[model samples]
Target: MKSTMANLWHLVKGVQIRDLGEKRYLFKFFHIIDMERVINGAPWTFNNHLLILHKLKGGEDPL
Candidate 1:
């Protein structure tokens, strides 16, 4: 999970880790992906999909 956060920190800005009590930390990261090429409502690309997976794995925030 640490590695995922690290990668996100490197790729995006405004990444934060928040303490939500009960020994829990929340990681938040934002990315802007263009979806003009989508035929239906699928607004995600392969890269974005991978990024979401990485974030969910509990990576450390580099920031």
Candidate 2:
């Protein structure tokens, strides 16, 4: 009864989410503050496990 990643435009203007393959989604935000907010202020939760968000450096891919 709800939409996920449906109102991306409402969240960030001119932002685009691209599929980088391997079940990974890349989001480009225009503002560095937005990225910092996501990395430091965003809240993630799971049913039984803690959600870990990693910052991938340039030319780095998680295998």
Candidate 3:
């Protein structure tokens, strides 16, 4: 498996934050110049879903 630093480097080189909204944030990642346009376009919504799933799975809160 790749180390965390390698993964982070890839992520950083490929991804960018586009916007932050009240309920969500937007992001984009580049893979191919014209063929692919990856758009997260809603970070907060994803985070909320993850939190809900974690709670349902009985994961301990880090707070």
List per-candidate RMSD values in Å.
11.0, 4.9, 13.5
Worst 10 residues of 1 by lDDT: 32-41
Q: Model 2, residue 56: displacement in angstroms?
A: 4.0
| Best-first order by TM-score | 2, 1, 3
Quick one: best lDDT, which candidate? 2
lDDT at residue 25 of model 1 (Cα atoms): 50
> What lDDT score goes with residue 46 in model 1?
40
Clashing residue pairs found in predicted model 2 = none
Q: Which ten residues in a row have the lowest lDDT in candidate 2?
A: 1-10
In the range 1-63, model 2's lDDT, one tens digit per residue, is 002332422344334556667655666666666566656754644344443556668888644
Tell me the RMSD of model 3 versus the true structure. Answer: 13.5
Count backbone clashes in candidate 2: 0
Stretches of model 1 off by over 4 angstroms after superposition = 1-9, 32-63
lDDT (10s digit) by residue, model 3, range 1-63 = 123322433443455443334533333344433112222321222323531111112364323
Rank the models by lDDT, top first. 2, 1, 3
- Score candidate 1 by TM-score against the native: 0.31
Better of 1 and 2 by lDDT: 2
How many clashes show up per model? Answer: 5, 0, 0
Q: What C-alpha lDDT values do all the predictions have?
A: 0.40, 0.51, 0.31
Question: Looking at candidate 2, what is the lDDT of residue 42?
Answer: 44
